[model samples]
Target: MTTALVTGPTSGLGRQFAIQLAAAGHDLILVSRDETRLTELSMELSESYGTDSEIIPTDLSDRDQLAVVEARLADP
Candidate 1:
């Protein structure tokens, strides 16, 4: 089971990437500042492709928040 981490998944290319990855049977770790959009994308992927996603509402420009994402990736 491959998992993809996608940033800025609320619109444009990032949203398309999430959908394409889900179609390819990849689970997701979606990162964005907008929790509402992230949750919406998560549910859409789950319903459309049986994809499971963990959404992290994060502003990556902030050092602390970037560290959080870095930690998850490092440990995973």
Candidate 2:
């Protein structure tokens, strides 16, 4: 199964990307500072597209947290 990690995916263009990618059958790893919005988006994607998604609420500017996302991208 293919996966795409998307940053700032709680709204606007980022949210659109998440939706489109879910439609395209990519399991999503979503990053956003807003946990509530991220969870909402994940549920919507699952209901709308039947695609599974994981949410990581984080500020990507932090080096340690950025590394966590980087690891997921690199290993996934």
Candidate 3:
């Protein structure tokens, strides 16, 4: 299965992207600033679409957290 790592997925375009990507049969790695929203969305997407969804609550504006995210993506 293909995986998509989507940043800022707790609201707006990012939220929609997560939903759509889940619907499209992609496993999702959802990143957002809101932990509650991220958990909620992860549950909703997993239940509704029968797809795996992982949440990483992160503030991308922070350089350290952004580096972590980049490292995760770059992992083999």
Judging by TM-score against the true structure, name the best candidate. Answer: 1
Question: For model 1, how does the per-residue alpha-carbon lDDT over 55-76 read when each residue is reduced to its tens digit?
Answer: 9999999999999999999998
After TM-score superposition, the amount by which residue 46's alpha carbon in candidate 2 deviates from its true location, in angstroms, is 0.1
Write candidate 3's Cα lDDT for 1-76 as tens digits. Answer: 9999998888889989999999999999988889999999999999999999877888999999989888888883
lDDT score for candidate 3 against the true structure:
0.90
Candidate 2 residues 1-76, lDDT tens each? 8988899899889999998999999999999889999999999999999999999988999999888878877775
N/CA/C clash count, model 2: 0
Model 1's TM-score against the true structure: 0.96
How accurate locally, in lDDT, is each candidate?
0.97, 0.91, 0.90
Which residue pairs clash in candidate 3?
A: none
Order the candidates by TM-score, highest first — what do you get?
A: 1, 3, 2
Q: Pairing residues by index, what is the TM-score of model 3?
A: 0.92
